[model samples]
Every structure is written in C-alpha cells, then in structure tokens.
Target chain A: MDDATRVEVAASLLEAYRTRQPIEPLVEKYAGLELDDAYAIQQHQVQAWLGEGRVIQGHKVGLTSGAMQRQMGVDQPDYGVLRDDMFYPEDAPVPAGIFLAPRIEPEIAFVLSRDLTGPGVTVAEAAAAVDFVLPALEIIDSRIRDWKITILDTIADNASSGGVMLGSTPTRLSDVDLRLAGCNLYGNGALVATGAGGAVLGSPLLSLAWLANTVGRHGVTLRAGHVVLPGSVTPAQPVRPGDTWTAQFAGIGSVTARFGQETA
Target chain B: MAAHEAGHLLDPGATVGPIDLRTAYAVQAEGLALRLAAGERLVGWKIGYTSAAMRAQMRVDAPNFGPLTDRMLLAGGEPVSTALTQPRVEPEILLILGDDLPGGSDRDRVAHAVGEARGALEVVDSVWRDYRFRLEDNTADGSSAAHAVIGPLLPAGVDLAEVGVTLIGPDGERSEATGAAAFGHPLDALGWLADALAAQGSRLRAGDIVLTGGLTAAVPLPSGARIRADFAGAGEVSVRREAAVPPSRTPADTAETGT
Candidate 1:
C-alpha cells in the first residue's frame, strides 16, 4: 500500500464508518499489500482529522475490558484518538447526524494536566499525571455502516469514536478515590445500569497508564490537556431522538445529554 | 451468508435514545428488556471479560457476558458489503457443540462430544449515532455485536495442541504470537464460555455457534480490499469489500518494518 493508497484506503474507511458500512476485512486485505502503507493510511487519516482543527481532546481504549479482550482475541487493549470538537456539554441535546451510529454510555473521564508516557509507566505514576476527574457520558457512535468490523479496523477508525459529554463539575484527582467512585445510569427516568470506577480497569488512572504505555510502545505519547475515557462504568446503551440520559457518580456528581433532531 | 442475519433486535418502529443512565450496563439491561418486549429470542450469551489483561485494563476481576440472539448469527464465510452497518473485522474460532453443557459444567469435561471449530469474524456495531462509545458503554451495548460473519467450520481434528498456527497479515508479515491471544485455543475459550454459561443455567447445545473470541489481533480491511486467513490444516477463509468513496481529508498512518 503506497502512501496514496494508504490515504485512499483510510479515507474510504472513514467514509464507510460515517455511513455505517463495512471496511475492516477490506483494510486487512490491504494490510497484506504493505505494512508501512497500511500504517501510513492510519496515521494519515488521524492526522488529517487533526489538521482539520479537530483538537485532539482525549483518548479511548478499546478492548480494555477483560471480556472484550477475550472476545477480540487480543492480549492488550487498542486505542484511538479523541478530539475536542466531539465533546458535548452534559445535558445538551444531541444534534442529528453528528455520528454514523451513536450509542450512550456512562464512563469516567479523566482530565490530565501533565504528559505521561513510557516503557515503564506505572499506575502510581499515572495517578500523578492527572489534573481532575469528572462524570462523563460517552456518546459512542461507529463510522461503520452495519457495526460489523474487526478490532484492527476499529483501531484505525479511532475506536469508533464520535463524541463525549462531560459534567459541569470537575473534581481534583486527590479529592476522590478514583477507583471506588460509583456510577449509576438512568434512562428516561429509569435506572438502567450501575457500576463503579473500579469497573473501568480498577481506576480511570490505570487505564491512562495502559494507554500511555501501549501508545508509547508504538512510539506515540499521550499529550497533556488530553482527556481519557478509561472505559465504561457499565455496559453501553442505545439511544434515540427525544431521549434524555444521565450518568450519576457517587462522589464526582453527574452529567446529562439530550437527543433530538440533528440540529438540536 | 450463514443461516442467521446479524442485526440489532431493536424494532424498526421502536424509539432510540442515549441511555442517559449512569452506566452502559444499564443500557444493556434496557436493551435486553426491549428485546424481551419485542419477543426476540435470546439465543445465547457472549462473554466479554475473558482476558486478564482486559479485566485489568477495565479494572475488573472477571469476564463479562452478553446475550446473543439467533438473529445475531450470520452464515459461515459471509461476504459483507461496504454499505451495510459499520463493521469491524476480527478472526475467531467458532464452536458447535454435540451435547448441552449445562450450568455448573466442569472445565475438565468440556471437551466431550465437541462437534467442530472454525475461524470466524465478529462484526461489531455500536447503536449510538456516531460510533462513539466506551468499553463499558459498548459492553452494555450488547458487547457491540450488531451481527457476526462466521467462516467455514474446521473439524474437531484440530484441538488446542495445533494452535501453533501462523497468522499472516495483509502485508505478508507473519506472526506466531497468536497463542492464547484469546485464551490459548478456541476450544479452551469455548470451554470457559460453556462453563460460564452453565453457571448461568444456559448450556451449549449441539448447534450453538460459539465465537471463541479473536484468533489474531483485529485487522483493518479497507474498501476494495480482501482478507485471507490460512490455518495450518483448518483451511482458509476470505472476504472482500467494494470500493468506498474517499472520506473528506482522511488521516495518515504509516507502518514501519521488523518483527
């Protein structure tokens, strides 16, 4: 896969993802054509997004959950970049068509003030890198058409990222247990899911370590001012127009997002 | 395609929304309730908390499981078009049981009357609007399983012992580190799944399609590309996507050499 070919493939993948189409097996097929070409396509695509002024806001670690790792047949988790433009204010109504396919989930989002990376990054070191913690709702949407994709395709698709919603309130990392913080989800006034910060790899900070080391091993470093959606505090739920969702954290408080027409 | 078509059990007329609830687990429960409300059958459950690394990554101590309906299964070696749902490609080992492994099944006796094992792909799609999701959200998002693309069945001849097979990527780079990437072997993973299911009073039947997690790391397939996987003796399976229109200003990813 030449650079042009890589870019073409990546562009097509992003388009396919946006339209809910399938592209992983196809991307893998191209993988056999060239290694450098394949990676070039991935980097090129993400960099293009960055170039477009989509501030890289946070990072998402897929297959971070043990169950996901087994199901995907990988030992470690894979990651994708997150951008600031994708962030939604908690309780804001979702604009229609902002994502190829969107779903709602309760997650712990960490605000990092310092850069962290290494071949020897530890959980303790990760904890020190954080600036604050907040309740977050991940509006997960995939660019794939039918939601059918392989893990590698997802990695290239930026982990099926769409947008995130953060609670208005922010708490310092030292103010909460981080791991012991609890979360509960409510949909349309009904309690739907419940979990703790520990559910996301024990602590959102540890998840940061995983991302820092994982990406660092690949020669990528996590920059400061980036937010990390460690993982879902609970399983994800599907959303529709006119639906109101809220995620409540035991200590950190909660955030809410509404959904409606594309412009809403 | 296989006998089943993979799709969201959500009714076409049903309303969708962001499960503003606290956790994705709630969303999953809500979805399951909706499925029950719509009279969709719960075929079986998928296990997500199967890897220690993943469990550690998400800060959990055990694996998690989700329900798989008869609707979620696709034919073996199905060619997924590019215009369908957002799809991710992952190679897996599928298990067909010869007997029902009821709840409380012992790990040692899990090998009894196993029918066949085959390489498979799990096509995961998030029901969210813009493919944005978290691990917990997706996990509760029915493990992000909108459908599945399974492949030709490998006979029971190949067990865990022959798992030293090579995984050749699209770039012609061969990697032999596929061992235990999904818990050593497909059957071993299946065994764990069966035992786990048994504990929930759900048993593996003679015809249940159990996707034994990923065989190799997830590979990205671009439009106009095809993926081919050749097992030592288990045979090979492939899939291709039609050309996709380029995305506006795509990213650049360059892969280097070695290993």
Candidate 2:
C-alpha cells in the first residue's frame, strides 16, 4: 500500500476507535497491504493519539500462542502500543460500553527494570531487564467488523489492543518458571480454558526478546518503567455484558476483569 | 558554621552566584568531612529534584544528591525537633539495597540490588534564613538533610508508579499524589542517582537506604502537630513535633557570625 492509502486506512481505524464502530478489514480493502505499510498505518494512529496527549504507557505483543495464531490465521506475532487511559483496575468493574465486542486473554505482564535497546537483545538480556511479572488480562477488541482481521489488518488496528487489567501482586522472574507457569481462565464461576506459559513462543521471555529486537529495527528503545504484555497463554475468550473473568496463574497471582452491563 | 547556627540574617533575594554542580558537590564533600570528623556515620544518600512536584516547587531542572547519616535517622512516631529553622516534611519512597549497586546507567542493576521499597517522610530543615538559597547553596547545606521516618515496606516487585501517597497535614486537610509524580516512577530516580554517584566515583553499598526524592512539594512543620503520610499498598508513617519550643521563627540572628 502507498503512503496515502496507509493514512486513509489509519484514519478509518482511528474513527472506529473514536466512535466504537467497526469498519471493513484493511487487508480486503487495500489488497496490497504489506508488513511495512501495516506498521505505518499503526504508527499513524499512534502518533495521532500521542498528539491527543495520551501517553504511551507500554507495548503489548499479540498472537504469541499457537492457538491464537491459528485462530487469527496469522503465522507470526505482532505488537501494539498501550496508552495510560486503557488501564482498568482489578478491583473495579470496567464499563462494557467502552468496547465494541471485546475478548479477553491471559498473559504475563513484564514491568521493565531498565531501558532495553535492541538488535541483539537475547533471552538473558530480556530476563535481566524484567523487574517483575504480574498476572494480566488483556481485553483485545478489533475495529474490523465481525472480528474479521488478517495479520495485516490486525497490525493496522494496533494488534487489536484494548484495555488491560493487572493483578495487585507481583512475582519475581527468578521465583516463577515462565515455561511451567499454568493459568486457568474462569468466566462467571465456570472454567473456560487452561494454558501454560510455554505456549507463548516456548517461553514468554523469548516473546519479550522478539519484541525488543523487532522494534529495535525501527529505532525504538523499550524504556524503564514501561510494562510489556507478552502474548496470551490461551486463545481469546469472548466477553459479554455482566461477565466477570479471572486469570489465575499457578505461581503468579491472579487478576480479575468485570464487565458492567449498560442495558441500553 | 551552619552546624553551630541554624538560621542566618541576609537578603532573601541574594544568591551565592552561578556555582556549577561540580563546585556544589565539592563543597558538599567538605561539609560531609566535617560531619564525619564530628563522629557521625554515613548511612545512605538522598536524591533531590527527582520529581515534578519537587522540581516545580524548587524551580530546578535537574536532580541533585546529598549524603545521609545515622544521626539524621528517625524512627516512626518519634518527636521531631522544633529547633531546626523552617523545617518541612516530604513523602518519599526509600529503596533499601540488599547488594552493592554496580556502577553505570543500567536500571536493571538498581532494581536487582534493592531488596525492599519503603514509604517514609523526610524532614527537611533549611539552613539559610527563610529557606532561601541558590541550587548550589542548597547542595552545600546537605540538601537540608534532617531525619527520615521509615514507614512500611511494600511487597517485593510492587509497581512504584501506582504507590499512591496521601499526606495529612497538621491541620485536617490532606494532599494526595502518587509515585508517578516522582519522575514517572521512583526507580527512575534511583537509576539517575546511580549514574550521579558513578560520576562521583562512588556507589551505593549493601544495606544503604536510597531516598528517591519527594512525592509532593514540602509542607510546613508546626509545633505539636502530627503529620502522617499514607502510601498505598505500603502503609502509613507519622511524626509528631515537640510542643515545648517555638516553631522555627526567624528573629534577627542575635548571635550572627556573618553567615
């Protein structure tokens, strides 16, 4: 896709975010939307949000799990920028009206101890950079109508990012084995799904390393104090009005997300 | 000279004039030598101007550091002396290092060395009259080092950015802010302190207390008044002022020695 087309596609996605309305998939509309163009489209939206005074709190990696990739029909993982306003507390009920059909997934949130520069960021380097890990539920919502999104379309939609709910407790990297950490997804008093940390590109640390190196090519340095959400352990689960979901990790603490009913 | 006299008589507008940070730190070293000679043992270090609240109140652009000593440590619920000139209190996050901080700008080392994060209130007493001083002069006065009332320890690996602080004044009124007010996160300030100390050929040792600046601008300390700051997820810290003395009023320094 050309620069002009990317800008136009980004504008539509931004409009969707603003109005909470879905639009046609960009991949179908553009047909030639390559990886670079998809990222350019995402950057355009990120810049626009930054212009609106919303801070970049961190970044989130998506499709890290084989289940999610197979579900979304994407072969590789992608990332999205997280804004400060998108964080909801684990103690409170998040308003459902904020999203246009949201899906929640379980992941490990990495809060960095220092700024990480890329290109040669290894698993050990990634491990050292993580100050601690928190159990997190990432509410992934797409701007593409009917949840129809190819990798290019999803990338253009900021990797289908939405709000995030984090647990109050934090576990040290050395204390918990990320590969063996298990999570049980619960919705409304019922077990919905189960997964292990190894589902995320073998280990979540590898996903972190992948993110650091990929964004390093674009001159991005993941700064200290920033939170990075590695991909979900299990596939995404659909959310409904008055739905209460929890992601309970074996060694890590759990985080809850409650969707409030509007009834209008 | 400041140890012998707490207050001074001078023009409030007068500045020591254009002293760089290097000169200021050197002067600070001289002051530290005198304290050490007088039998005070160094305990920790304090970084100032690390928070937007602190920087906005102090009108300084960059952060500065000063040494803390055993004599300046105060336990929780202790009575603060009213003798210090124009004393004010600030809520701060103190990181207790379990290991020696390796030199350089890497924040990973700063986090690894810190065994615990605690909430505390730092009692800052000014030396020159009316708390008036240039940036360099403030440094030489030991960044107004007075006492630290250590409060509660937060859970390990807890996010410092969300550490909400509620400072209850001598009066019933309360001022609120969070750890993010301190340079987005307290650890960032610690990272800066690591680099600053490294430049000075020093490193934070194991068991050292590192105060990561104030979460809020300073509030006045009054006689018989109890001030408490509640840090979310950590706990609360309180200090009571001695009621027997006048609350640091600046009369003409009757015994002024040209300070």
Candidate 3:
C-alpha cells in the first residue's frame, strides 16, 4: 500500500477506536490488501498515538492459540502495541461505551527485565528474560462492523486490543510449567470458560519469543521493563454493559474487571 | 524534593530534614509526581545501601529505595552520554519480577516470584552536590539513581547467590565482586524492596525491574569509557560513554538499506 493510503486507513481506524463506532472492513474497500499493508496501517496509527504523548507500555501477541487461529481462519499469530492508557487496574469498573464490540479473553502477561531482540531469540532466552508472570484479562474490541474481521483487518486494527486488567499475584516461571498452566474464566462469578497456557503456541514463552523475533526484524526492541501479553488461553467471549469478568490462573492469581452501565 | 531534583541547592532543613523513613518516602512520591509530569516514565524500583557498611555509614538499620525511569536506562550496545552530573558506575544484579510481590513476602517467595536474574551496571548520580547527604536526603533524591544497563538474562532457577561480576572499563580498570555482597543474596534485597514498597501501599508488580544494591563500590564514570559487566553465567552487558545520537533509523536510511 502507498503511504497515503496507509495514513488514510489508519485515520479511519483511529476514529473508530476513538468514537467507539464500527466501520466497514478495509478488505472490502481496498483490493489486494496484504498483511504488510495492514501492518503498515497499524504502525501509522501507533505513531499517531505516540505523537499524542501516549506511552507504549509494551506489545501483545494475538491468535497464537489454535482456538483463536482456527476461529479466525489464520495460520499465524499477529501482534499489537499496548498503550499505558489502555490499562485498567484490577477489579476496576471498565466503561463499555469505550469499546465498539468488546469481548474478554484469558491470558498470561510476561514482564521482562532484560531486553529481548529477535530473529534469533529462543524460547529459553525469552523465558530467562521474564521477571514474572500474571493472570490477565484482555478486553478485545473489533472496529469492523458486526465483528467481522479477516487476519489483515484485525492486524490493522491493532489485533483488536482494547483494554487489559492484570492480576495482583505473580508466579515465577520456574514454579509452574506454563505449558500446563490452567485458566478458568468467570463472568458474574460463574465459571464460563476454561483453557491452558499450552494453547498459546505450545507455551506462552514461545509466543513471546516469536513476537520478539517478528517485530525485531522491523527494528523494534522488546526492551527491559516492558510487559508482553501472550495470546489468549481461551476463546474470546462476547461482553456487554454491567458484566463482571474474572480470570484465575492455576499457580498464579486472579484478575477481575467490571463493565459499567452503557453510555448513550 | 522537587526543588532538590530541579538542581536547586537547599539546606537539609528545607528538604527531608530530620524526617523518618515514612515521611521521606512520602517526599519521594511527591518528587516522583514532578518527574512523571516532566515525561519520565517509571520503569522499576532500586534498593540502596543494602550493604551493612553503607547502611552503617548512613546510620540506618534498613535500606532506602527509589524509582527507575526509561530515560535512566542505558541499554547494552548503547552509548552513555556525558549529559549527567557527577555520574558514577556500580556493578549490581537486577531481579526482574514476573509476579506481584506484596510487602512482607518471604525470601523464598520473592525468589519464586523472580523470572530472571541479570548482570547490571547502575549509573549513580546524586542530584545533591558532592554526594553529601543524609539517608533521608538520598531517599528523597531517588537514591541517587541516574541510569542503568541490563546485561544478558539468565533463568530464575540458576543459583545467583554466588554469581561473580567483573566490571572492566575502557582503561582496563577492573572491579569484581559476587552477588553475595548484596544482602547475602540478591533476592533478599528484592524482598526488602517489596516490603518497602508495600509499606507505601504499593507492591512490586510484574515487569518491575528491581536493582539489587551495588555488589561493589562505585567508581567515577569518565567520558570515553567503555564499561562492561560480565556475569559468570548470565553473559555480559556493556555501554560506551561517548556522543549521544538518536537510535531510531531515519526514513532515508530505511529506504536506502531496504530494511
């Protein structure tokens, strides 16, 4: 895609994210849209946000799990940038109107102490760089109308990232084999979904390592003190106003986020 | 605290004069707000005076703590500029927390919560002139922390209790120590920091970078110096003191290189 088209597409998506209004998919509007074009649009939007003084807290990997990839009909994982403003404190009430079509998924978050540069980063290297792991809830929102999105569309939309809520407890990587780490998601205090960390590219560390390498080729450095959110352990579940969601990780702790009443 | 951090010289009375550790931390929080307003992002916390000698010199039974920022981090392979005042360097171990550790967590728990252990170079630059200050004064000054360079990371299970660190300078000046110099084990210092932060109603969150106290005495950071810290098993991290340049690739460079 040309730079002008990338900028224009980014602007439209940014507007959708800002106003919580869904728009038509770019795949329909622009013919022959490739993953590279979609990522270009996403990068343009990220640059805009950075220019506006929003801090880049870290990055997130998406669609790494078989469930999500199968559901999306994609064979590979995608990534998105996490801004500081997108974080919701644990158990805080999240505003539903801030998202177009919000959904919740359970995941693990890795906090890095040492920078991880990729293309040759190994899962062991990624594991060694992790400072701690926590249970997290990723609130995914789609900017495409009716939640319809191809891999390219979602990638352009920053991998459907909306908000993240982190648990208070941290579990060391050595204490639990992340591949077997289990998660149980509760909505309104009822168990609604279940998954294991193995679902995320065999292990969440592998997913993180994959992301570090993929973005490293583009001159991005997963620096020390950055948070990396691996893809969801469970399938994304639709959410709405007045909903309270909690995700509990085996060996880790639990995190909760509540949705407030809908705004007009 | 704000006046002190802005480079304003003040009598101890005008700053953290005769304050207790609790009040000193409150002052530190206020100063941290000013830093955040000035666009400095908080990356992690640092434990100071973990060594008995330093604590005894400061006449304190416990250690002090401070915050770390993005601007204060000098990555390995990056050059350190002479933009800081009275900058000194120390070799230390960094504990990267993968979990949220509340105050009062046991050492074992702290160790279990750690995800990585790394060799580190801490650039300590006291905002206070001459580095002459009381414990409270240093506490309010962010523990004299200026910048840090994190070397390669090792898995948490690796025994860091006795890992050796060797600091080699551009002129071949060498300083060496072991992790045991940091409160017996680096995890102990981490546990102490967790408690300190917890006392302030904060916990060590996941992704928080905690710099254990200096393993060896600090030395002057001279310009044109290349400082490297070699961790016995964790690999090495180095920083060169030279000119500062933007690390980002220019569009022209990208176009030319086709990267």
Candidate 4:
C-alpha cells in the first residue's frame, strides 16, 4: 500500500523491461501479498503512465495457442493492455533496445465500429460491431529479464504487450469469412507460418466474444475503435536485430515491420 | 485409456497427417525441450484447445493435450529458474479426479468425484522454426506447453464448484471469469473428458493432473515476464518466461499448408 514503494517497484520493473533483465527477484520481493492488493498497486502505476498522455490502444491474448497451454501448464490464455505509444505503422522499424524481451507474432487485427457488450453476445453479434479488419503484427515485449516470468509478472507488466503494426487494407468484417481467412507469415521473405482464420477459437470473432464476456465480468466495455489482436496466427518467434516479419492475409492484405537490436 | 474423456472434439491439426499423440515430430520438439531441462522427468499432462476459442484460433475444433514434465511442476513458495523458457503465463484450476467419472455431460457424477483443486499457471513457449506454427500444428503438438508450475495443493473439499476467479496482468489490468468459463465447471467437463479418454481407450489415473481449462482469457507474457493466478483459497502458482533460440529448419517448413 506504500505509493512510493509501488512506484519504485514499477520504475525498477520498467527499467528491467527496457533492458530485458530478469524481474523474478523483484516480483518475489512483493509476493505473498493478496492478489488484489498486488494488482491494485500495479494498476496505479500503469494508470499514472496513462495519465501522462499515453492512450490505451488495445489488448492482447497470449498463450492462445494449444502449444502454449501445454507448455505453461495452465488451461486458458492470458491478456494484456495496449497503449498508443506501443503502436507503429505497419512498416515501422522496432527499436529492439526498448524491449527488455521481445518477439514478433503474426496476427489478424479487428477494429470495432460499435461498442461490443454481452453475457449474451453471439459471434454474429460481435462480428457486427467490427468496423474494419486489418492484417497485423504484434510486437511482444516483457519487462522481465532472461525471458523468464510467471502470470503475476506478466500481469504486472501489462501482459507483455509491446507494440502493434497495422496493415492498410482495412477489409470489412461483413465482406469476409473470418473463419476461412488464412495468412502467410513470412520472415525475411520466406513463408515461415501459415494458418486459417479458424485458428483463433474458430474465428477471430470468437476471441472478441471471449473478450466481451471476459471484460464484461470485470465491469469494462469494449469501446468502438478499439483493436483486438485476437491471437497469434503463428506462435511468436524471436526477433533479432534486422529481422523483418510480415503477415499476408489471403484477401485482407497484409502488415510488415522490422526489428532493430536492443540498444539500452 | 485415453485420459479423462470429455465429448470428443476434432483437433484439426490432424488434417496435415497422422499425429502420434504420444510420439511424433511434435513430441520430439517437446522432447528437445525436455532434454534441455537436464534432469527433469515426466510429471503430469494437460488438455489444450478444448474451447471453441482455441479451436478457431487454430482453425481446429478439437482439444489437444500435452505432458507436464517433473521439472515443470512447482508448489507454492518454490523458487523458479527464470532461464527455463520463452514463456507465456496463464491462470487455470487443475482438477484431480477422485473417482473415475465417465466422460459425457454427466454433471452429477462429476460434481461428486471432485477430489482436489488448486490454482496453477501454465508456462508456455513456442518451439517451431522461427516460433511460427499453425493452429493444427500447435494442437497436435500438445499445444507447445513447456511446463506446469503448480501452486500449493488444496484438498478435494474446496467448493470450486462455482467460484469466480480474477485474472490480473503484470501491469494490474484485471479480468474475471467463472469456473463455468471452461464450458462451465471444468470438473463437469472433466467427467466428459474422462469418458472421452476412456472411449479412446485411455483413462485418467489417480495421480494424473487434468488442467480443467483456462478460467480467464489468454494474455501474453514476454520472456522473463512472471505471472500467477489466485484462486481464492485454492492457492496460487507462479511461472517465468525465458528466451529460446530458433530451431533448425525442417521439411515440415516446406510442407506447411494454407499459407
């Protein structure tokens, strides 16, 4: 409950994140506290950053793949908040130095035109709220060093969400069969991954439904213009300096970006 | 016996070719990881891709499962090696069966056989070349589960039957879901899972650990990102994400479909 202590912890964590240093010891320093208490303190830290002018841009789902579930030993996936400072143009060069730990994942991004709410929101209903769908990439970065962390560490780090690369195509949701949409994930010009739209819980729309009900339980609403990167079409791959990754959706166009070496 | 059989769903990854659930190229991928553990051994297993969300995410409709190696297991207060994995941390409740309940929609029997409950986090990592894999590729590969860091175990008396759990992110953004989120009461789903496994010629033994499914949505954890899930009195589990070098490329890379 010490504001200074929390800020100190948050600041220290952010530094580690920027350098990709380990944060296990730091997190353990605060372990044993109530889950709610731990989160409240962290929320304050992030909100403070937001108050300084960073806008909350979107959210991310990690461990959405089956491989992640088995590897991690948990059943479901996890989520993180996205901020405007984290987004770059589809072709932006990601400075690797800012991410303590970083990876690149190919994904499909959907922008909602209307607020999506539901205990009863159906896939059809969730899809109806979409404004445009873009082929995108999520740059995942964590504040923990050595690339090691737990749910608590990730939660405190905002779910390891770093930045997003948006495509320009802007396909209409109603015009496409998201379930059938497929993407070719290319690294350095070679196809490295391929997945159908169905890879994300049947369709990316299902991710929206899951988010709607999930956030609804937390008393939050899915506002319009919010972009949801349903889940990684391909498992995330490590990005070294100078690595370029791109995702081409069958009919939705594509998004691309490059990574620079960590400088900090 | 196919472990706890829930209603059988199709794991679309099966479309590429035959997948040896116990042994295959995918298992080998996991095997390489196991070898990386130095002296770790098999501990338990988990079911993945059970929900429609997962199926669609992978463009598959069935659930996938993976083994939990000994090195991956953790109890409350246990120290973790942050160097172990390129991790994604997730919260879930592990359901240990008391009596073998048939897998189907048999809620009553499922409710009765709940032996023990605990909150745990699944620590996952991507292992394919460049860390890119399709939904089916992940599904059949046991969902690329790297480890299962379990928390303090709880006795079977815990009435997790219908409790609400919250999923908090590293930055403290919060979300909540009920036990019902896993198709409602994963224990009930366990019955069906058990039955499904039995039908497939397998059965979940007493010592087996069945990850009921995720309670909240999936969130990302960077390498070194730590995470946990507090299941009220059910105890909490922790995990750390680690960085991994890309594996050597293979022909599967050439045979990849739908790209």
DockQ of each candidate relative to the true complex: 0.02, 0.01, 0.01, 0.02
TM-score for the A-chain in each candidate structure: 0.88, 0.97, 0.97, 0.87
User: Which residue pairs in candidate 2 have backbone atoms (N, alpha carbon, C) closer than 3 angstroms, thus clashing?
Assistant: none
Q: Give the TM-score of candidate 3.
A: 0.51
Which one is best on lDDT?
2
Question: What are the per-residue Cα lDDT tens digits for candidate 1 across B68-150?
Answer: 67666666445554434455555555566767766555565666746666665565554533345445555566765544556
lDDT of 1 at A36: 43
Report the Cα lDDT for residue B142, model 1.
72
| Superposition error at A260 for model 3 (Å) | 1.0
TM-score of chain A of 1: 0.88
Better of 3 and 4 by lDDT: 3
**Candidate 1 lDDT tens digits, A1-264:** 456666777888767745655554554466555434534556776787878776777788766655466677766666677777788765557785556667877877878888887768998988888888878888876655555656766665677677788887889887765554546577887655544565556456778888888778778777788888888766678877778898777557878888876521
DockQ, computed on Cα atoms, for candidate 1: 0.02
Which is better, 1 or 4, measured by lDDT? Answer: 4
Report how closely model 3 matches the true complex, as a DockQ value.
0.01
Q: What docking tier does model 2 reach?
A: incorrect
For candidate 2, write residues A89-113 as lDDT tens digits. 8878999988987999988899999
Model 4, B218-250: lDDT tens digits are: 666654355665554354556544444445667
Query: What TM-score, over all chains together, does every model reach?
Result: 0.48, 0.51, 0.51, 0.49
Worst 10 residues of 2 chain B by lDDT: B3-12
Model 2, first chain, TM-score of 0.97
Candidate 3 local lDDT, A1-264, one digit each (tens): 788999999999999877778899889998978999999999999999999999999998988865467788887899999999999987568878888888998888999989999889998899899999988899988899987898999999998899999887888898876764556677897656555676678678889999999999999999898889998876789997999998766567788989999762
Cα lDDT tens digits, model 4, A1-264, are 466776777777666654566566445677554434445545765676788898877677666665566676666666667778888875557887777557888777889899987667888888888889888889887666665666656666666787898988888876765654545567887545555455566457888888887767667678899988888765677777778887766557778898775566
Q: In model 1 chain B, which range of ten residues has the least summed lDDT?
A: B1-10
